[model samples]
Target: MTVSVAHGTARLSAVAGATAGDAYVRAREALTAAGLSEDDIVQVVEYVTDPAAGCGEARPAGVTVSTVAVEGLPEPGATVAVEVTAYRGGGERIATGSGVVTVADEIVYVPGILPADLSAGFREQYRSCLEVAGELLKAAGLGLDALVQTTDYTATATRAEYPHCGRPRRELLGGTGADGRPVHPGAAGILVDRPLTEGAMVSLDAIASRRPLRTVNPGWRRYETLTYKPGIAAGNTLFMSGFGALEPATQRAIFDGDLLAQAEYTYAAIAAVLREARLAGNAVVRLVEYVTPAGIADYDKVAEIRAKYFGGPVALTSVVCSALLRPEFLIEVVPTAVFP
Candidate 1:
């Protein structure tokens, strides 16, 4: 296990083994390395290649934990990646915590699948999950309209099923509502090899707030891309769009067949957008990397770039996927930053 911390965020990467016990032990050592204890942890994001490998049962009762099963991991044989957010001091209890839901002020964190019969098909399961999310938001005095960011982990062979997954989100979250007008949250869909559940087709993870959000698109000309904001800034946090190694002006992929160069270019692009939003690399709190198998082969190069770009600790998760939005694209990076 390798642990790093910066500005209260801790990232733990382990490949020693894939069991839940190994993840727990690594997380414990990471907290100690960050000079933090279990009580300081606010959120935990776990990535596993096999959902059946369950996260160890050694976690504290009230912390927010979100786990997802991905296709592969950056570490050659590693199947689990754990990222944690801990405060400088004893973190305040901003909101009540339940099994997989945590509420704090304007933020809500929910992970894994919503309680629903997996016997249904993908569309039915997705709608049921969103229905549950809507009800939870209403209970918290929020609604689907308050969503700022979302991640859809779907068990599919390709991106063809992406539209089917987005239908529910569009109906539930995109459009005019009682809230006066509607806003679409920044979203990213990753094709997972499998879900935590045996027959489940899709799993949803989200972060919502009561505050309004503003979208940021730097150096935008006109190009065909998915329907999502480049960056959504709400309160002190900036939710960035997934960036690939593409030229800023031409919007064409750069460094074909070169994973390291593409990765460096992608990071540089993300940094440029951060600067446009008046933030810096150190402000980043969380980062998710979607990579193909070839990219994973040279994972060390990516880690070296990450270590050089951010001087402090940042929670990180690297997932191996079948493919990104495009076949030529080897890596896609999603980053979120909290400002001072």
Candidate 2:
């Protein structure tokens, strides 16, 4: 069983020792209690302590389940800690995220459905991923255009295989963004290299969107338009998505070899987003830091940089991975913010 806490319109569910059966039952109960249909539940963010149960079960309709692991949660006896966040309309839901500093807006919008059972075949499954994304956007009164960021996780994926896995989804939304075309906000591929279940291939997630706008000296990036939705009025908001820390001349990270340097690049990149949004240093809300092996070595430096740039209260999450998209790029950042 699980306890829930809801305040200021934020709904949170915490359950321990949850099985797939428990999630199903809870979904039914929650909808009934909330005066909403089962369809109202858009996504489930499950923190699985024991992966043996396989992260509970498939997601119900209009719902997508994202799995994560926490050091401790629910209770001592709890093998699994699960939380279900119900979005009435275009609220934000962070789906399966990984990185050093996780920002508020970095949370991807996931529809209600089991990831493994997303579709019948990878081709159809791939299309389904885009279709689900479209639905989530529609619910928020945004179109595929609102899809500003994307992280695709697949098994043994390569540049050659990206077209096959990612092209269909991109085509459905718009087209590829490789050459300054209207691409799907930010798109990148990750190599999972692990076997997953059915309907599960290329697990993807996204950030909430705001209509884009152009600004003169929006106070940040020189040549970028800034647009994003706030979590709450006078509260924190989404900063930017998929900003890299590469040297303009070499098109590589300014501090490629050192983790602390890579961490520095991430902080600097996030600054650009804040500038574009016309936000100040104080308005910076959250951080999602991504680092390769080299960056992991200097984890303490990464923490130090974070303390320097974002001194105020903030939410953060980080991840150490084998590599990032660029060889010379050791670190990257995605940020979210709110204003007082």
Candidate 3:
């Protein structure tokens, strides 16, 4: 499948906001400080406490947007946190003007899509989400059968039900291998204690491309039966799956209770993927850190750890959440590396 292209990444959570407009202004200010303007933005990711409360506002011109209602933002009292992926250089880009973006001869990024029936059951909500992605891509002359990556945001109350949602995902993202196995995307799932829209159980942000993909596993066989790859390489870009400090062999969390230790293991794993993909740490353009409440106090120290792994500047974001897929997973990371 395909995924989003990233030349650069930036975090907007550093800006404190009392309102959506205030957050937007503060975000613009922060971008200016970083030497990036709105014209460079390719995508916008916003996290809010309530979607039905109108917490999300307009984003930069010609950018794809993904707004999810989560537990909280990085800044206290901030109603929303925004993150952006900017176009730094080197790619044939196309914004379909309908939330679908593509890198010609590479991959396609389908904008944020959720089920139309917010009150539906988990299965229905999930199927509809993928269906929406399929429809949107269809309008842009693409197909969802090539979906290579996805980020699912589900209501925390339905935690146990997410695994089952995979059933619908497989049914819709249909590309069975010759071995009779399902072709799964490199997926990342997060749980939210509070949803922006009342009764909205799930929402999704996905990417797909008809281009060929090479799996970058770093010898992690545990992903063979999973719905995602450790990393997927499309042309010169690598889309890495969300990873914590878990040991793939035993399925046990490593360096438990220590945020820095966990982050180290996580970054090492990421490094392994880069090495296998023939990329260097410097190739990474974005990092999205999902930190649980337990790790927030220690989150500031993570930048130093990140520096040890990535050789250059990165668009980084650290978002605090009530909990992760597992309580022991104090932090999880998803990164995109672009080859220069």
What value does the lDDT take at residue 241 in candidate 1? 70
The TM-score, computed over Cα atoms with residue i paired to residue i, of candidate 3 is 0.85
Off by over 4 Å in 3: 1-16, 30-40, 55-58, 88-107, 174-183
TM-score to native of every candidate shown: 0.81, 0.59, 0.85
Off by over 4 Å in 2: 1-53, 57-64, 68-108, 112-128, 136-142, 155-160, 163-170, 174-189, 195-201, 209-236, 248-250
Models ranked on lDDT: 3, 1, 2
Ranking 2 against 3 by TM-score, winner: 3
Whichever of 1 and 3 has more lDDT, that candidate is 3
Model 1 pairs whose backbones collide: 5-313, 6-313
In angstroms, give how far residue 91 of model 1 lies from its true place: 6.0
What's the lDDT of the predicted structure labeled candidate 3? Answer: 0.72
On TM-score, the leading prediction is 3
Candidate 1 residue spans exceeding 4 A from truth = 1-18, 88-98, 114-117, 174-183, 219-227, 246-256, 307-312
Q: State the C-alpha lDDT per candidate.
A: 0.68, 0.48, 0.72
Query: Per TM-score, what order, best first?
Result: 3, 1, 2
